[model samples]
Target: MDATKRPLRIPPQFATYAQKHELFELYRRLIARLLMEKPEDPLTFMLEELKREDDDVPAIVIQGPPASGKTTIGKMVSAKLRTAHITPQILLEDDVSPLAAKGRAIIDKNQSIPMELWVQLIQARLKLFDCIKKGWVMEGFPENREQGLALQQVGISPKHFVILDAPDTVLIERQMGKRVDPQTGDVYHTTFDYPSNSEVEKRLVEPPEGCTEAEMTQRLVLYHRHIDGLRRCYHKFTKVINADQPKADVFSQVITALSSKHRSLAPHIPRIVLLGPTGCGKSVQAALLANKYDVISVSSGQLVKEAIANESKTGEAIKPYVNRDMPVPDNLVLKLIEDRLSQIDCVTRGWVLRGFPRTREQAENLDTAGYEPNRVFYLDVPNDSVYERLTLRMTDPVTGIIYHTLYNPPHSNQIKERCQRHPEDSDDAVQKRLAAYNAYVEELSDYYQTGLHINADQDPHTVFEFVESMLVSQLPTNLDRD
Candidate 1:
């Protein structure tokens, strides 16, 4: 009988997996992947990646010595991570190595897996794991410099490295004090998580027969020997936490550390740019994405159109040029955009900007205005799709809220009376806009450091989700408060 198999009811969500195993894998993968190396220019690489349309995910590394409450911390932290928690034990379960058969036998007999084979196995398995979307968190896999360096060679950056530490005495005592249920193999710690049953609870406080002080001491010694070198390997991003304190306290620090680090640029307002061709849902997506991800939005086209609708002096100023679909002068566009950006909505609230930088000169002037976006999203809708979307455009003449008959149709009976057709809604006008877009799209796309290409031909929700998920990847900190 498996002693570790507790008859105690595990949540059905965890019925297929052991709770401990799930937590270990959660953090092991996170920490391993945090060291995911990148090329010389990651953003430039990302630009090329956008052209090819690849998947890129953020990775976190939770590193610590054994019995330092790292696994417990990993378990607690996994609940908050947006990505997968990957552990070393997952490697043993999904082995394809030539020596996997022998490795299985050795592990079953309780022998340590050899180092050379250990590295190979971990590297191989990680190759298949996906960190291209929601990134991953890792725990308890890399204990030495070899494993750490091997991970970097595999192209992962150690963006966040957290080390859980405790006094040698406390770690040994904690390990030695644990009571293992021989029948169920469940481990109970008197100081932390303990079972509810009286007998099980009693066993935790009083170490059972197999629990010994010696093994704990031996394990601690072995861990300390290699921990220094391991820590040095990832010193750049390492954050140390004292695990001798209460688990909750230690975990709180873990949360703060991970949150502020590579989790997303914390405390830095997300500056995002959504530059795409006309009618590619750039305006629609910018508005949706800004609302969904908690950012403000401004569009050059929207601003000019709004000015025209308001019949402002600037509106009449640009009306002649707009009537002919001719490009508005940069000075006129920049002034309107600058004034709009200074308004209450865009000042404090981070903005998703579009439309101002219509040319090389405008892009340079945008820099002069002290606006630089960290993330750029390119809506790569097919030309035909762009034309189709533009042709269907409708707008509420009163409120200036945009709608599409198929995509964002207005519900009110007044739509027929109140709505206005976009001047470019005609087939020839749509074609002309697309042609103009193609003429300058490459230069504009190349102006930024990196941009993510999105397939906007899909449903609105899918497009928004992809853009939102990408923002979450780059700047995941939720700005949900004052």
Candidate 2:
């Protein structure tokens, strides 16, 4: 993590005995050029480095004054975004009103915690997490300029900073309105959420002297002093939301801002939709394209199945139809697919969607969700080819690697021996899937005005060559690689 101590570049040397003069000169020039290269910005370098290492995880930071809704907003954003949420309070001492207020005197008077102590807390807390890998949404750390610099020093630059802004009056009202259940850590607000009975509520507690107007004014002063400088530091990635608005409106603004910022990180990544029949090698091509292009491959069916397995709300709603061998309603399916595709992984890494948009309605929904693909690939293989490939197909369940008994086989028998065969690889199941795809394939294709139609009956290499070449020609040169 040290920004200093860049690796030493050993100078090139030539042996006296029988050295090729041209090669020696080339080596000397290369070494000199290496020495002349300017040093890199370590923070920028580390940002790229971690994205490559943890493509699926997105690290986020939410910053605001004490009562600007950082905690509530952080929690909601984390759930909607499906990323880890960490509050620095937990990084402080175990049990207190605000965990960050350890030596309570300074903080109790609406003053800043020591810069060194705050930085140390962040460092220790981060060490316990694989934040680089799974990503994180952090709240209430980096309370001021120095702490933000400390974060930079540690090579942790967030993808986005959500900065909530509100008037002093609004923040004061929020602070006064909110109450906490220390036993369960459940927070309630006077207007948004309240106890059933004021007197009968055994759980309620009176506000401390800190709830008074004078104390609130001091807290506001402490809060504003810190945020203005922090905002200046993170202006490029900061989205200022008005916390004075209604709760739902504020939340909606936060979601839109965060989502837009995340997408902005990856400008034009050749977002693609692979549409074809079940046995037309859609999954195979999706995987091949993802690997060659260094992007993500998502299977819509698998996403739906996963939702079902997790018993999500969407899954619960779609359970009856899916069980009855009918397609899950477009609304539920589209929501699930939209959530998956909008994740940080897809935004930054790029993505190829499979088994999605089987019908015109679903395709329209995908467009509504802002998934207008750079190109829609329709693999046009004959019915005979489809059946032939399906009958011979076997999958390694552990790896989800598709193999055709006649066309493609495991190179080593040892691997072939251990592969878990999927139960649905049976011919009956394959026919059912193929029949379902055939019924609606025409309508799906008609949904798009233009598309790349490949004769998938050809060998895999030839088809992939055409598809990749078309993508290369269409996408900017900046794309075609991560």
Candidate 3:
């Protein structure tokens, strides 16, 4: 049977779009008539067309943050086009034992295939030229500039690059909520929007020991490199979909882009998440992380505030506790966290978790509930320093900006009236608060032994340097000393 000249089978659902264009309308009517009167003949004609040389199956590339539904979308798109879904990860995994036997260090301790493994996998996949003649949807390959170039060297160029853009806040929240099956590596997230079978909970896997901030950053850097390559080479053939929007809306935009005949450019979308503590300059640090990472910050406190304003059940439960300087119930806090994480934009990128897990019990709840941190940073400010800093705290009534009267006073002291008034009995209250804070720190120090501690009394830039140093030290290297 001929492969290239096969008769087209336009689904009934797409009949409307086909009717809107003259060329498509004629083709659609002809196909519909043939299907009704001469089904055998139409199949035979399509087989002939399949054999013809002019028809080429379209190629679509889907890219997005981890757990952003890229794989699911890839599968759906491939099914719609009646093409093979080729994921490089699958290819590499199939060949891992053989590749490793040949001295190819293909697998990391995380059991993920390395870059070289991808190169080998791509080379092997490309050998199936005849099989891919009908085209295939390639997912999870060309992870960086080098890999992309490698694919180009092997004469494989995708027709379109579909970039799924989502906010990092969404990504982080999603990631924190994500659970993978240890046995089969199936990924699942807890959400009403993406419901999973109750049995899926049994498959949750624990992350490997020593999964540190440095390790997470290394993976991110690799992702960045690959994304950069996609932007550089396929910039013209790119279609960016904001995955932060409603799933249906995002899918519609994707379908529209894929059905279009010509390639079009899409805007670059950034995802960011901010993480820090209360009154330890987490907000300021979040801004720094946002600027450095080129993504937006998702503030947990802000989310809680919004929830409280909306009088969400969980928020309402937390309101009295927070107002009375008491910790909310673990289940209530978890509900709040879960709700915030389910938002489309929160789990897409790096994010900060501010004003969360203030107590050891809360932190333990986070771990038990499966919200692990790639890194935990402690701002090690002395009690005296914190006292001095809080003593001068002031708020701008108009802009809601926080200022320090000692170091960052308002212009000409015009807003001095807005300075936070210390309690007449503040001396005792401050001492009590300091004692509680110290106790919390002592427990935190014990809990996260590997946590990076930055001196908060220093200049902000200097503290950032310490952060960068910690990150650099965490990179994958054979050096014994960290």
List the global CA lDDT of all models.
Answer: 0.69, 0.71, 0.60
> TM-score: which is higher, 2 or 3?
2
> For model 1, where is the 10-residue window of minimal lDDT?
9-18
Model 1 segments beyond 4 Å from truth?
1-266, 308-313, 323-325, 392-423, 474-482
For every model shown, what is its TM-score relative to the native structure?
0.44, 0.43, 0.41
Predicted candidate 3 versus true structure: per-residue lDDT over 107-176, tens digit per residue = 4444655566566666565446643565667776656667666666555568778888776556656665
Candidate 2 regions exceeding 4 Å error are 1-53, 94-113, 196-201, 206-209, 261-482
Worst 10 residues of 2 by lDDT: 9-18
Off by over 4 Å in 3: 1-278, 294-300, 323-325, 396-403, 417-430, 472-474, 479-482
Query: Alpha carbon lDDT of residue 372, candidate 1?
Result: 55
Question: In candidate 3, what residue range of length 10 has the lowest lDDT sum?
Answer: 263-272
Residues 387-458 of candidate 1 have per-residue lDDT tens digits of: 667777788878889788787788877885688887768888878767877888788877865778888888
RMSD of each: 20.5, 23.0, 24.7
Model 3 clash tally, residue pairs: 37
